[model samples]
Target: MIHSTININNNNGNNDNNNNNNNNEIEEINTLDSLSNALKSHITFQILKDTFNEYSKLIKYGNFVSLKHITTGKYLTTDDKKYLTGSRGQIVFSTDALPEANAIWKINYPFGSQPKANNEIVSYGDTISLQNKLGKMLWAYPNYKSPTSGHVEVSCYSMNQYNNWMIEPNISNISTKKNSNEEKRYLKSEDKIVIWCIELVEH
Candidate 1:
């Protein structure tokens, strides 16, 4: 899971205030208009590569993967609720203390891009999209700034480049080593991974 910053002065000001005052409690709001997450972020299952080969390397196209935040152990989730902001995008956030219904994400290539005819295996550095049960895909808006980090805003939108992500292994925070020599290795569920490009990552 990732961080969706909640400004103390936003519409959920009262909840944010309570989160600050209450040490052991916080609201779980996950909409753009009132982004307050006490749970998790949009993440992919990641296990440290030091023990990568111990797991099955078979994450293929059309697989339903619940990306678990390697650090927080949270699951990436979203809903059909639209953002009240100008983009009116679907809300993307992290939740589920464990992988649950809201955390399930479908894996696939870009909607109109060249399809993989023979290989269904997802390779390292492949550009892919993660779709939720509501049919919205994970999106990162480079044009919009996040309310918290002043970086690109990550949400669930459509099947465009913004939604396409390049995945790699052994990246920082996720792993300390990078196997650049390994031209293309099959990616498996729970394999510590990094999704970059406009910063849609959970490393």
Candidate 2:
């Protein structure tokens, strides 16, 4: 089972606002925390093992990995396991638990550019896109059901930034290899770079 640690601060600042406004903000934060906890409780080790086994074969690119939310320590996942028929309204959410089938994402390089292993400068126009097992690409909207939702969704259309994603590996995983045949090859051809073994960590 996946576990998440959340820190909630209830400190009151010396502001001119009335007590009612502070109480309201506190209430909203508590509600959001409750929802996050509920999502975490649903994840179990069996579900994660099963999901990994089922999707292991579909992962082709070395960059393909599970995305962990920076703040929540949760994975991105679909609202349900049901198949979506290329609908733009398909819902995606952050889950405070191990990912299921819908959460697996394949990182794809920009069109016309060859894939590289090094952490080269990838512009927004050349940013990678995330594709799920269902063949839908991840999309984000400026305005959706709510402003706080971040407007993340999956779409069939291959739009610009809506489809583009920036994925950076955990800093601890980035290291240089010395005195190896692969390093010699990389020195000969800078274009041919190899990414060492990496353990995906929360952003």
Candidate 3:
């Protein structure tokens, strides 16, 4: 359901089998792995789905998505906070009322798989990377100095464990009489149902 564009340039082997041959041009292969990796480095902007769509498609591997701070109504922004004068940058929620270019992020699944559908919401596994448009990743550094200490920052994409984050829907904004725990679980399961329906339709 979620359509993502992935550009893969695979240079496996050249046409010439012998080393002396200059015409051994490398062939380009398109595979899931190549697509996934390409998606990581090539995602430049936000890829939002149509609001009118009934079911939310599971975000494909390497697709760009925006993270909206539920309470602030602001999107996650990159390079808003700088720890050092010339340091890479830090991640912060934008103060602007509307989403901006810096707020766009690419969801990176280091394990190489698509985000699973939980109810209508897409669930990234235990850990995922939120890579900003600037090619830096959102990182949370704890045990550091003040302000920057225990705060989110952006660093060069290194597939670091600290950069991994668990993304979940903000249930606090959901208005319901049900208990918080119950509501969260219900919503997740409901999303699963929506995903199942979409699967059925595809089949």
Candidate 4:
């Protein structure tokens, strides 16, 4: 479920203390009402939307599974990177143990301009894109793997040539030291990449 439900229960006090217990119950009800009203504010909705959107986005383009190449149909082990295109729905794998997928998971990346060094040449809302880029890069591996244990450096480039670097807003990078088995060796056919839900195979 997207959210958990809240529950409240009432308790009856002893006969000798019935009056006092009733007063306590009233106070509890007032507190609950205040909390409910506070949660109804627009700010609350925005926070919920933003959090859900980030999670949805992460799951979409971030399914790091035992992917089977469309052309070669070969299976890859961990630490491999394959340049993928099309929605996540279009990609299929041979093994089971896949992470949960979502329909609205879109791969968000900045491709406007960037630099060779790890410095920011352009700023788009202060590290939001950087966080987003890092999230996408995290998908290069399964959740069972360790992130802090090793070094993962992702850098952005201009285009398929890997020569001309894009400006700040436009960011692209490669996942270093991937256990990638099959490499497409070509850029995706479409300009934008998307992730969608597909059938899972449990092995």
Candidate 5:
């Protein structure tokens, strides 16, 4: 069974909340109301996942996981904050701040192409969806740049080159690091992970 069902009260699928303008400019940037596996591009970096460098645990569908930005040591987060310009999108930023709610995300199978079993763990080459507490799925604006960072804008948006994420394991702060089988690497809770999204250009 699916671990949990997220109830997004999006005006019964209407953008009526747009009028609320409660400083939640982030949610309005998403026009992808449908959460199906709409990404048509193949994994642009299929050659990279073969690097068995770090032993990471397998993430399963419907798993609530936290993704921390490696360099900044901050959690990938989003909220009611808005960007002053660019895509007019809601802001998606990394923060080393308190209040853990916004930093937590639930991993989901793409809407229509769900797995036969909900407990199926993530493996190499698996494409997944990430949804936040506010019920907004993780999204990115590939064609746009952030007004501040001037990089690809990633927010609780929708389908793009999720390209497929490579899980990089973090083993610090855990009192004990245990691997039952020498041949297997199991990712555990609070494990630090890196998500890489590379854009491919077809020539």
Candidate 6:
């Protein structure tokens, strides 16, 4: 299981116009620790395992079981996985890859700066194999820095249903990694990047 932590703060919108607005309660933000715990509690690792299984199948047999290309509405699985090269190569996946299968959780590196909500950058464009899983898509987004935290979101989709009628039930998992000065630059301070995951569930 994976988990995360977060902090809650009061909304900063206090004005005279809506003085009587009773819905001004502060929003709850998960701390790094809280985010981590939540993901673990939800059995997120199991979800990833399933996604990878499905992804691998497409590569092996050539098919699209979920989302369309948003343009082609057709199945598309590139053969790049077989002959992957240097860094930032074409999209690919391998069972023996890092953040191993059923990887419980993984932290991303080289991720710099945190963007406001709705500003999630593509961390990794990879695939998973989830032959028969309950959940849709489950992903984790590590914090950009320490004390700030990271997040994870999950969603579900169906191939038999209408193309645009997919339902997404997502949960963000945020966790912060603590490090020391002597550790490697990437390992020393876990504040330069954010790690996130996506789990496509079948309903």
- Whose TM-score is greatest here? 1
Q: lDDT tens digits, residues 102-200, model 3?
A: 666665664454556422333423356666566666665554433443443434443544576654443333212346565422122122221121111
Q: Write the per-residue lDDT of candidate 6 for residues 48-151, one digit (tens) a residue.
A: 87766543322111111332223333321222222222222122221222221222222111123232332122121222222212222222212211121122
Model 4 alpha-carbon drift over 4 Å, by segment: 1-33, 41-76, 79-94, 98-203
How many pairs of residues collide in model 6? 58
Q: Write the per-residue lDDT of candidate 4 for residues 1-203, one digit (tens) a residue.
A: 12333333355555556555432232222465565654555476779977764433221122222233334444322222332422121122233333333111112233344533332112222221211111232222222222323322222221222122121222243111224784321111111111211111211
lDDT of 5 at 197: 20
Q: 121, model 1: CA deviation in Å?
A: 0.9
Q: Write the per-residue lDDT of candidate 5 for residues 90-190, one digit (tens) a residue.
A: 67887776245576676667655635666665543355676766677777778888877888876655443352334444444422334675333434444
Minimum summed lDDT over a 10-residue window in model 4 is located at 185-194
Model 4's number of clashes is 23
Q: What lDDT would each prediction earn against the true structure?
A: 0.59, 0.45, 0.44, 0.29, 0.53, 0.27
lDDT of 1 at 184: 52
Candidate ranking (TM-score, best to worst): 1, 5, 3, 2, 4, 6
**Model 1: CA > 4 A from native:** 1-57, 98-101, 117-119, 158-161, 171-183, 195-203
Clashes of each: 8, 0, 6, 23, 5, 58
Predicted structure 3, TM vs. truth: 0.43
Estimate, for each residue in 123-199, the C-alpha lDDT of model 2 and write its tens digit: 22235776665666677654443223434334333343446654333333222345656431111111111231122
Please state the error at residue 14 of candidate 3 in Å.
78
- Every model's TM-score: 0.56, 0.40, 0.43, 0.20, 0.51, 0.15
Off by over 4 Å in 2: 1-63, 80-88, 111-126, 143-162, 168-173, 176-203
Give candidate 1's whole-model lDDT. Answer: 0.59
The prediction achieving the highest lDDT against the true structure is 1
Candidates 1 and 2, the one with greater TM-score:
1
What is the number of residue pairs that collide in model 2? 0
The TM-score between candidate 1 and the true structure equals 0.56
Let me know the TM-score candidate 2 reaches against the reference structure.
0.40
List clashing residue pairs in candidate 3: 15-24, 16-24, 119-190, 119-191, 119-192, 120-191
